[model samples]
Target chain A: MRFNDKLRLAWKKNNSLVCVGLDPDLSRLPAGMAQQRESIFEFNKTIIDATHDVVCAYKPQIAYFSAYSAEEQLEQTIQYIKTHYPDIPVILDSKRGDIGSTAQKYAVEAFERYQADAVTINPYMGFDSAEPFLNYQDRGVILLCRTSNRGAGDIQDLIVDGVPLYERVADLVANQWNKHNNCLLVVGATWPEQMAKIRNIVGDMPFLVPGAGAQGGDVEQLVKAGKTADGTGLIVNSSRGVLYASNGPDFVEAARNEVIKLRDLINQFR
Target chain B: MRFNDKLRLAWKKNNSLVCVGLDPDLSRLPAGMAQQRESIFEFNKTIIDATHDVVCAYKPQIAYFSAYSAEEQLEQTIQYIKTHYPDIPVILDSKRGDIGSTAQKYAVEAFERYQADAVTINPYMGFDSAEPFLNYQDRGVILLCRTSNRGAGDIQDLIVDGVPLYERVADLVANQWNKHNNCLLVVGATWPEQMAKIRNIVGDMPFLVPGAGAQGGDVEQLVKAGKTADGTGLIVNSSRGVLYASNGPDFVEAARNEVIKLRDLINQFR
Candidate 1:
C-alpha cells in the first residue's frame, strides 16, 4: 500500500495524528536500562508497546542509534514495530541529502536495511537526491521545509524571487515533485504562520510536524494552522517530552500518559 | 592536530590533492571478491595501500557500507586508514543534517563511532545543525554549498539578496561559522564558474570538490577555478572512476594508474 493510504488508515484507527519520536538517548535512558547491550531496542519496544494504539506513526531518528554503534538495534527496533504494530508507519528521521548516485545508497540504507515505511530527506541537493527515494512509490519522501530550529531562517527564510525560500520549497514539492503522490513536507510546529502558508500551497498534503514537545511548539496553533479539512494531516512529533517524561521505573506509564495527553490535546483543536 | 593542519601536512607529504572516494558497491566489487564477507574492507585496503602515497585524503561515503549492513566494515576501513596511513585525513561523506539535538548524535556517529577526521554535512537546516559537529574543534566540518549533481541548481541557484544561495552559503560559512577554523565548503567540480565565485568569497578556505571522474568534471577547469593562490585549497575526489576502473584481477593497478594520471592532470592546471 502507498504511505498515504497506510497513514489514513492509522489516523482513523487510532483517532490521532501524534507520532512518538523514538530518539533513545543512552545518557537519558530509564534508570537501569542504560547499561544493557539491547537498551535502545528494548527502550523502543517498551515505548512502542505503550503508545502504539494512540499514534499514527513512529519516527526513529537514525543518529541516536548509529552514534552508539547500535545500528543492528535500530534494524531490530523497526522490525519489531513492523511485526507488532504494522499499522503504524515508521518514519526513519534521517535528514540525508547527497548527489544522485550516493543518494541511491542512502535510499537502500533507509528502505532495505532499516525497513522503514517512510524516510525523511533533506532537499538542499534538489530533485536528483530525492528521485531514488521517490522511486519507492509506496514509501514516504518527507522533505524539510520550515525547520523548527531557531537558526532555520539562516537559509530557509531567504527570499527567492518574492517568496521566502521555504515557500518556494513548498511550491516545488507540492507541484513538481509529488508525481507519485508520496511526497510530504516537514513544516515545523514552531512556525504556525509559515505552517499555514505551506498548507495553502500544498493542499491536503500531509505534514510531519516536529517541535511540539521539547521545542515548545504550541499544540493549539499547530493544529489550527496545519490540519487538513478532514482534520487528519499532521503527524505531530514529541520526542524528549514523551520518552523521558519520567526517568524512574514509572517511565513507561509516564510515556503512555504523556502520549495520550498529547493525542487528546491535538484532537481538542482538530 | 586540527583538520587544516593535518590536511596541510598531508598535502605537503603526498604532493597530490586527489582524495579517492571509497564507495564500494557490492554489485560493483571485483571478480572473486564480492562473495567474501570482508570484500569491502579488503578492496578499500588495496586502494588505500596503492594510492596513499599520492593522495592527501580519503573519503568514505557512509551510505555504501550502511546500505549493506556493513557499517562495521566502514568502521574498520577508517580505523585502517588512521592506523596505517596516519597522515591522511578521512572525510566521512555523510551529508547529515538535523536540528541541534539530533545533530549532536550525528556528530558522535561521525567523530566517535566512525572516527572520521572530517565529515560532510548538508547546511539546509542552518547553523544549529552544523554547531554540534563544529564543537569538535580538532575535526573538520565540511558543508555542502554547490553540490555536483545535475539538479543542484533547483535550490542552489535561486537568487537570495541579489546573490545565488550557494554564494550566500559561502559567505555565511566563511565569515560566521568558521569560528574554530575547522569549517570547509563542498563546491562541485562540475560547476567550475560557480566554484571560482565561491573561492573568491571564501578565500583560502579549503574545498572538498567531488564530480571529478565518472561525473565528467573537467580537471583543468576545476583546478584553475578552485585552487588558491598557493594552489592548495581543493581536495578533488573520484569514486566510480577509481574504484571500478577495472573489475578484473588487475583492478588494483588500474586504480593506482588512474589516480596518478588524475593527480598529474590536476598538477598541469595548477
Candidate 2:
C-alpha cells in the first residue's frame, strides 16, 4: 500500500496520533544488559511491545543506531517491529540528502535495506537530493521544513519574495514535489503558529510534528492549530518523555502510560 | 593538528588541489573481478595507491559503500589510506545533519568509526545540526552552500535580504559558525560566478569544489575564481571523470592520468 493510505489506516485503527521516537541513548538504557548491539534491539523490542497499540507509527532516528555502530541491530529492530506490529508504519528519521546517484543509494538504504514505510530527507541540495526518495512511490518522503531546534530560524525564517524560507519550502514541496501524494512536512510543535501557516500552505498533507512533550511544545495548541479538518493528520512525537519515562524496570509501563496521556490529550484537542 | 592546518599542509605538500572521489558504482566497476565487497575495497586500494601522491585528499562518498552494505569495507579503506598515505586527508562525503543529540552521534560515526579528516553536512537545520560537527576542534565540517546539481537553485536561489540564499548561507557560515576555524563551504565548480561570490564572502577559507569533469564543471574557471590569494584553499573534486576514466585493466593508470591532468590544469590557472 502507498504510505499515505497505509498511514490513514494506521491512524484510524489505532485511533491515535502519537509517534514514539526510538532514539536509544546507551547511557539511558536500563541496567543489566551489556551495551552491545543486541541489547539495543532488545530494548527496542520491549518498547515496541509495550506501546505499539497506542501509536500510529514508530520513528527510528538513525543516528542513535549509527552512533553505536549498530546498523545491524537497527535492521533487526525494524524487522521485529514489522513482524510483531505489522499494522504500525516505520518512518526512518534519517534526514539524508545528496546528489542524484548518492540519493538513490540512500533511498535503497532506507527503503530496501531497512524496509521503512517512509523516510525523512534534507532539501538543501534542492530537487536533486529529494527526487530519489520521492521516486519511491510507496514510501513517504518527509522533508525537514521548519525544524524544532532553537536556531531553526537562522535560515528557515529568512524572507524570500515576501515568504519565509520555510514557507517557500512548503510551497515548493506542495506545488512541485507532492505529485505522488507521498510527501510530508516536518513542522515542529514548538512553533504552533508556524505549523498552522505551514498547514495552510500544504493543505491536508500530514505533518510529522516533533517536540511535543519533552521539548515543551503545547500539544493542545498543536492539535487545535495544526490538525487537518479530519483531526487525524498530525503525528505528534515525544521521544524522551515517552521512552525514558522511567529508566527503572517499570520503563515499559511508564512509556505506555506516557503515550496514552499524549494520545488522549491530542484526541481531546481534536 | 587542526583540520584547516592539516588541509593546508597536505595541499602544499602535494602542490595539488585535486580531491579524487572514490564513488565506486558496482555497475561501472571493471570486469574480471567478482563484484563483491572485498573487490570494492581492492578497487579503492588500487585507486588510492595510484593517485595518492598527486592529490591533496581522498573523498569516499559513503553512499557508494552503503549501496553495497559495505560500510565495513569503507572503514577499512579509510584505515588503509591513513596507514599508507598519512599525509593525505580523507573527506567522507556523508552530508549528514540532525538535531543536537543525533548530530553528536553522526559526528562520532564520521570521525570515530570512519576516521574521516573531514565530513560534509547540510546546514538547513541551522546550528543544531552543524554545531556538533563543529565542536570537533580538529576535524573539518564542510557545509553545503551552493550545490553542483542542475536543480540546485530551487530554494538556494531564493532571495533573502536582497542576496541569494546560498550567499546568505555563506555569510552565516563565515561569520557565525567559523569561530573554531574548522568550517568549510561547498560551492560547486559548475557555478563559477556563485563560487567566486562565495569565495569573496568567505575570504581565504577553503572550498570543496565538486562537479569538475563529468559534471561539466570548468576546472580553469574554478581555480581562477575559487582559489585563495595564495593560490591554494580549493579542493577540486572529479568523481566519474577520474574513477571511471577506463573500465579496463589500465583503470588505475587512467585515474592517475586524470588526476594529473586536473591538478596541472588547476595549477596553470593559478
Candidate 3:
C-alpha cells in the first residue's frame, strides 16, 4: 500500500498520531551507561510495549544510534524496535540529503536495512537528492519545511523571491514531488502561524510535528494550526517530555502516563 | 595546523593535489556480489595502497557505504582507512547540516566516531549547524560553496539580496565560521570562474574542488581560475573517472593510470 493510505489506515486503526521519539541521548539514559548499546534497545522496547496501542508510528532519530560504536550497533537498535513492534511504522529521523548517487545509498539504508516506513530528509540539496527517497511507494520521505527548533526561522523564514525559504521548499516538495505525493512536510509546533501558512501550502500531506513537550510548544495552538483538509495528518512528537518523565526506576510507567496524557489531549482536539 | 597548511604540506610532500575518492559503488565492485561488503573494503585498501603516497587525501563519500546495509560498515570503512593509512587525511564527503542539537550529534559521529580529518558540510541551515564541526581544532569542516553538478545553478546560483546563494554561503562559512578559522569551502572545478570569485571572497581558506575527470571539468581552467594567492589550495576529486577506470581485472591499475594522468595535468597547470 501507498504510505498515505497506510498512514490513514494505521491512524484510523490505531486511534492516535503520537510518535514516541527513540532519541536515547547517552547522557540521559535511564540506567546502564556501561551498556550503552543495549540500553537503547531495552529502553525502546519498554516504550514501544507501553505506548504501542496509543501511537500510529515510532520515530527513531538515527543520530542517537549512529553516535555509538558501529553502524551494526545502530542497525541492531533499529532492528530490535522493528522486530518486536512490527505493526507500528518507524520513521527514522536521519535528515539525510546529498547528490543523486549518495541519496540512493541512504534510501537503501533507510528502506532496506532499518526498514523504516519513512525517513526525515533535508531538502536543501534540491529535488535531485530527494528523488531517490520519494521514489519509494511503501515508504515516505519527510522533508524539513520548518523545523521545531528556535533557529529554524533564521534561514527557513528568510524572504526568497518574496516567499520564505521554508514556503519555497514547501511549494517544491508539494508540487514537484506531487507526481508521487510521497513527500511529507515538517512544520514545528513552535511556529503556529507559519504552521498554518505551511498547512495551506502543503494541502493534504501529513506533517510530523516535534516540539510539544521538551520544546514547550503549545499543543492546543498547534492542533488549531495543523489540521489538514481531512482533519487528519499530524504526528505530534514528544521526546524528553514523555521518555524522561521519570529518571528514576518507574520510568516506563511515567512514560506511559505522559504519552496517554498527550494522546488524550490530541484526541480531544481531533 | 589549518586545513590548507596540512593540504599544502601534503601536496608538496606528495607532489600532487590529487585526492582519491573511495566511492565503493556496489554494482561496480571489482569482486562479484557475494563479497560486496568485503570487496568494498578491499577496493579501498588497494586504492589507498596504490595511491597513498601519490595522493594528498582520500575522500570516502558516505553515501556509497550507506547504500549497503549501511550502519557499521560505513563506520568500519572509515576506521580501516584512518587506522591502516593514518597519514592520509580522510575527508568525509558528508554535506550534513541541521539545527544545533542534531548538528552536535553529527559532529560527534563525523569527528569522534569516524575520526575524519575533515568533513564537507552544508550551509543552508546556517553557521550554527556548521559551527559544531568547526569547533574542533584537529578537524576541518569544508562548507559547500559553488558545487560542481548539472543542477549546480538551481538554488546555488540564486541571487539572494544581491549575492548568489553559493557566494553568500562562502562568505558566511568563511567569515562567520572563522571564530575558529577551521573552515574550508567546497568549490567545484567546473565553475572555475565562480570558484575564483568565491576564493576571492573567502581569501586564504582551502578549497576542495570536485567535478574533474569523468565529470569533464577542465583541469587547466580550474587551476587558472582557482589558484590561491600562493598558487595552491585545491583538492580536485575524480570518482568514477578514476575508480571505474576499467570493468576488467586491471581495474586497480587503470584507476592508478587515470589518477597519474590527472595528477600530471594538475602539476603541469600548477
* Candidate with better DockQ, 1 vs 3: 1
Q: For all the predictions, what are the DockQ values?
A: 0.90, 0.84, 0.53
Candidate 2 Cα outliers beyond 4 Å, as residue runs: none
What DockQ does model 2 achieve? Answer: 0.84
For model 3, how does the per-residue alpha-carbon lDDT over A204-262 read when each residue is reduced to its tens digit?
88999988888888888898889775667799988778878988888889998998889
Look at candidate 2 and give me any clashing residue pairs: none
The lDDT of each candidate is 0.93, 0.91, 0.79
Per-residue CA lDDT of model 3 for B133-166, tens digit only, reads: 8788768888877777676675677666777777
Q: What's model 1's lDDT at A4?
A: 95
The TM-scores of all predictions, comma-separated, are 0.99, 0.99, 0.94
Which digits, one per residue and each the tens of the lDDT, describe model 2 over residues B158-244?
999899999999999999999899999999999999999998899899999889978889887888889888999899998999988
Put down candidate 1 lDDT per residue, B118-228, tens digits, no spaces: 999999999998999999999999999998999999999999999999999999999999999999999999999999999999999999999999999999999999999
Q: Which fraction of the native contacts appears in each prediction?
A: 0.88, 0.80, 0.39
Q: In DockQ terms, which candidate is top?
A: 1
* CAPRI-style class, candidate 3: medium
Evaluated at residue A235, the lDDT of candidate 1 is: 96
Q: Which segments of model 3 are wrong by more than 4 Å?
A: A32-34, A73-84, B31-34, B70-85
The candidate, 1 or 3, that scores higher on lDDT is 1
